[model samples]
Target: MTAHEERPNEPILLRRDEGGIATLTLNRPQQFNSLSMAMLEALIGAIDDIARDESVRAVVIAGEGKAFCAGHDLKEMRSSHALAFHQQLFRLCGRFMMKLTEIPQPVIARVHSIATAAGCQLVSMCDLAVASENARFAVSGINVGLFCATPSVGLSRNVGRKEAFEMLVTGDFIDAREAQRRGLVNRVVPPDELDAEVERLCASILAKSPLAIRMGKQMFYKQLEMGLDAAYQLASETMACNMMCEDAGEGIDAFVAKRKPEFRGR
Candidate 1:
């Protein structure tokens, strides 16, 4: 890697690699990986780098130690020094979550423990998520006098409105299986199988054409806000554009030749 492209090295987070998968571990276990300004900055920088780096195909966001994330740093929030800093701090956290959705590479949240408040927002913002059966999730900001207003943006889009509303208003934790049933997570496996299961899922996504994956992910979110007829029109236009890509041509040619296609992500 280039000098300016060095991997992130910070106490708030840890970075590890395997093939094209970049695993980012939240390191603030003492605080349950709660969002600190520094940690949020590191995460945004890491994701921005991944977007520009051709070598990274997929990403996994997980936490070290017990909890996935407990949301914002409540200790920091309660400080007299934090009164004037709240708006900027929350904006940074929101940007970090939005970056996960905007990045071209798919992000998988590996939830092996509790994820609450903004933590739940992080899970919902990812392209896909796999949780350990022992894991639990909640939007507990309501109990604290905050409404989880920002988290609801992503949570509402992922789960049914009623379910999101219940989680937001009641501030109750739900089991991993219940989260899956409510469409908040894609899969739930045993705690011991969490890492292996995330690898298995990422491996499958990495096998597809990278260019198509990028375009499809971008379009998927874009069309979600459009009217059905307009969305179909946009989709058709996107497909036509995708068909013209070099990877698509090679994919079709390789199919006819009955051989695997070598994609360069052109």
Candidate 2:
């Protein structure tokens, strides 16, 4: 797959192909795709749209230019009215992040360059992430006197507490390989191979029953916060429910018949 040629007039570009994959590209590369108020609103809107869209089975979040996102727009934060804007801005940002968990569609982050501060938080929010080998990641807000409080929620959950703390405190960059070791990303490939790798991964997921994939993703996150016993209990309950779905029945029948299953996603 070639890099998508973006068209003009596409703010928070949304494109869906025949394969049920939806790609959302951040369109503000002029500022390193910084998270300005407008961009934040656009992103939230796009995610909301995808959540409600049945045609979109898998979603990929990518940036328009070199950087995935540079985090919050520093220029906006430096305005004279910064103090007055924090509450509203944080509320929107927090809500946008939380929405990622609520959505049933599997979301992937296609990271090509640096994902810093909130950008890094965005990566952590994704169900899966594939990065270019040259990509650099950091929670660099602390160095600027702003703690990456929100990012820590996702980062700490993925990586060890000590490792998360080290990145947060030092605001140092970590290469893609270390990011994979730390569980920040699922895989790393060359920049030229990023699109193909992401497409390959998404296609694998798309081949599964949509309902199964949706419920599985939901249960995965829910069980993450539960005790082992509680998690097992939840998993058992979810599996029972999944087995009752039409797709599950078809899958079982197909296996017995030695034929490929055609799932209707019921």
Candidate 3:
């Protein structure tokens, strides 16, 4: 976004696969891994691809360099100051955030250094986040005279309104420990241990029945927007359907037989 343009030969997002875990690392380290238009497009494409790839049971979003994402490409916005461009840019970003939840497999964020503005949204958008103890977080666009309205949507959902508002309005940074205390992140570990902790969480989910995880993820997000009675109705139906799946049947049978459940992903 700055004078330094994204080189045609350089990747904005890098993908690595292992044991069904997809690790997507934002690749523009020189820009603090900011989400430039190209990076956003790459991420959106990757998300869509992962949605269709049943083999990828879990996804980890991480950054390649000193810091996690610093939010949108500020330089790009300055270069292209039209309302039409702004609208499309924001729509695309918001859609990608929503897509993170819509995907079947759980998304885990490996956070470090600073995650601000849309970067903060990235952490909040994740199903779970494991932050390095020294990591910092903030929805800091307000400091630059821009309100983090979009980031606040995800931030408010993760933390309390008062806490979220304090960060948004003040542009204050929270350490990983504080983030965990406020529910912004699930765990905080020594910086060197971040990867191990993320993998531990991934393995925990990997051991579960994929069918149960997929259906539960759907029911979980849907219930959040429902009235109490409606939520209960939907959850009950989902549970019934889940129990009818072969994985559930096998799980119960395995329990009765005193053995680990062998999930067929049915």
Query: What does candidate 2's lDDT look like per residue over 88-202, in tens digits?
Result: 7777778888788879899899999999999999999888999999899999999999999988998998899999999999999999999999999999999999999999999
Model 3, span 34-70: residue lDDT tens:
9877778888899999999999999999998999889
Q: Estimate each model's TM-score.
A: 0.93, 0.93, 0.97
Candidate 3 local Cα displacement, residue 262, angstroms: 0.4
Q: How many backbone clashes can be found in candidate 2?
A: 0
Separately for all candidates shown, the number of backbone clashes (residues 3 or more apart, or on different chains) is: 0, 0, 0
- lDDT-better candidate, 1 vs 2: 1
Clashing pairs in 2: none
Scored against the true structure, residue 9 in model 1 reaches a CA lDDT of 49
**Which one is best on TM-score?**
3
Error of 2 at 236 (Å): 1.3
Q: Candidate 1, 262: how far from true, in Å?
A: 1.9
> Who is ahead in TM-score, 2 or 3?
3
Predicted structure 2: lDDT = 0.87
